[model samples]
Target: MEMKSAVAALAALAHEGRLNAFRLLVRAGRPGLPAGELARRLNVPPNTLSGNLTILSHAGLVEGRRAGKSVIYSARYGDMTRLLQFLMEDCCAGSSDICAPLRDVALACACEETEPS
Candidate 1:
């Protein structure tokens, strides 16, 4: 990702509500969660969630598609990967220990899928 794009994505996630929403969406996986369910999960009002989702969508961190009456939102894995790569492209500078924990967290993201609430 370019510096500008990375900054946009990071800035969007800098807010507490947006960060939590993104993490939840990531855990919820590609099927994602409906707008109502996501807002309910975060205990935020729909309008607030709508605004947050808009920021996330604009940053290419999430995408929403209409399903029936609600929009189902999911994380954009490719953009996320690019952002991660941008941050870690020179990570550790060949030090295995320095990057190990980050690798572990990334691996756990794949292995640990939350059962829907």
Candidate 2:
């Protein structure tokens, strides 16, 4: 992603509620969740949730689709991976061990993705 897009995405996630909502959607994976369910779980009022969701969606962190009467929100996995790779792209500093643990965590997440939830 370009610097501007990355900055926008990061800025959107900087807020507490938005961050939490993003994380929750990430964990929810591609299946996502309805806006009402998300609001219910986050204890967010409808109006407030709408604004936060809009920010996240604009940031390319979240996606929503209409399913009958509800809107289901899901994390954009490709965008998320690109964001992470961008953040870590310049890392290592000649010490592979420094990032080994984080790589392991990334691998673990990959493994989880391969399995059925």
Candidate 3:
């Protein structure tokens, strides 16, 4: 990802509500939740969640598709992975141990993705 896109994605996730919403979508996997369901899960008003989702969408961290009356929101995994790669591109600093935790996180996420939800 470009520096500008990475910055925009980071800025969007900087907000508490937006971050929470993004995390929820990420955990939800491919079958993302609807806007109303997201608000219900987060215990926030629908409009509030909608606003946060807009920010996430603009940042390329999330995408929504119209499903009848509801818009189903899902995290853009490719974009998210690219952003992480951008942040970690210069990592390690000559210490392999320094990047071990990141590897662990990726492993955990991979495991989670494999299991049935």
Candidate 4:
């Protein structure tokens, strides 16, 4: 990602409400959650959630699609991965030890996933 794009994504996530909503959507995975359910879960007003989702969508962090009567929002995992890669590209000035913990966490999260049986 370019610096401008990364800045936009980071700035969008800098807000508390937007960060919380994005994290929830990330956890929800590709299928995502409906707008109403997201607002209810976050205890945020519908209008507030709408604004937050708009920012996230603009930053390429999340996307929404119409399903029936509801708009379902999901995290853009590829963008997220690219953002993370950009941040870590110059991590710790070549100190592998300093970055080990991050790699460990990523691996742990990766291992947690299982294919449908």
Candidate 5:
């Protein structure tokens, strides 16, 4: 990802509500979660959750799709991977051990290919 895009994604995640919402969506996996459900789980007001989702969508961190009467939101795994790659592009100052733990955590949370948006 370009530096600008990475910055945008990072900025979007910098907020408490947005970050929590993004993580919840990530854990929800490919099936995702409806916007109403998300708000309920997060204990956030509908309008507040909508705003957070909007920022996340603009940052390419999350995507939403219409499913009948509701919108389901899912994490954009590819964009997330690219952002992680960007952050770790210059890691450990050439010391693998220093970055090994981070790699382990990332591997633990890695997902298969995501459905196209």
Candidate 6:
């Protein structure tokens, strides 16, 4: 990702609430979660949740679709991959160990997706 795009994405996630909300959406997977459920899960006020979601969506981290009367927000995996690439683009000055933990985390996330609910 370009520097500007990476900055925007990072800035959006810099907030505690927005970071938590985005992580929750990522865990919710491609099907995503309805706004009400998301708010309830985070114990956040509806208006506050709306604001956080707005920031996340603006950063290209999340996308919302209207399902009935609710807006279901899902993580934008392509953008997420770009963010990951941007962060690790320079690695630890060529130390592969710098990315070991990240690779583990990505594997964990993938495992979660394939596991039986």
> Total backbone clashes of model 3?
0
Best by lDDT: 4
**What TM-score would you give candidate 1 relative to the actual structure?**
0.89
Superposed by TM-score, candidate 3 places the C-alpha of residue 71 at a distance from the truth, in angstroms, of: 0.6
Clashes per candidate, residues 3 or more apart or on different chains: 0, 0, 0, 0, 0, 0
Candidate 3 structure quality by residue, lDDT tens digits, 66-103: 99999999888888888888999999999999999999
- Residue 102 miss distance in model 6 (angstroms): 3.2
Candidate-wise lDDT, in order: 0.91, 0.88, 0.90, 0.92, 0.91, 0.87
Is candidate 1 or 4 superior in lDDT? 4
**Candidate 3 local Cα displacement, residue 58, angstroms:** 0.3
- Residue pairs of candidate 2 with colliding backbone atoms: none
Query: Candidate 6: misplaced stretches above 4 Å?
Result: 111-117
For model 6, residues 1-117, the per-residue Cα lDDT tens digits are 899999999999999999999999888888999999999999999999999999989999998999999999988877988888888888777787988887788777753333212
What local lDDT score does residue 18 receive in model 5, on the 0 to 100 scale? 97
In candidate 6, residue 33 scores what lDDT? 95
lDDT of 4: 0.92
State the weakest 10-residue window (summed lDDT) of model 6.
Answer: 108-117
lDDT of 5 by residue, 1-117 (tens): 898999999999999999999999988998899999999999999999999999999999999999999999999988988898899999999899999999898778667755444
> Candidate 2, residues 28-111: lDDT per residue as tens digits?
877899999999999999889999999999989888999999999988878887888789988899999989999998877742
Q: Among all windows of ten consecutive residues in candidate 3, which has the lowest summed lDDT?
A: 108-117
Candidate 1 on 44-88: residue-level lDDT in tens? 999999999999999999999999999999988778888888999
Model 4, span 1-117: residue lDDT tens:
899999999999999999999999989988899999999999999999999999999999999999999999998888988898899989988789999999988988842343321
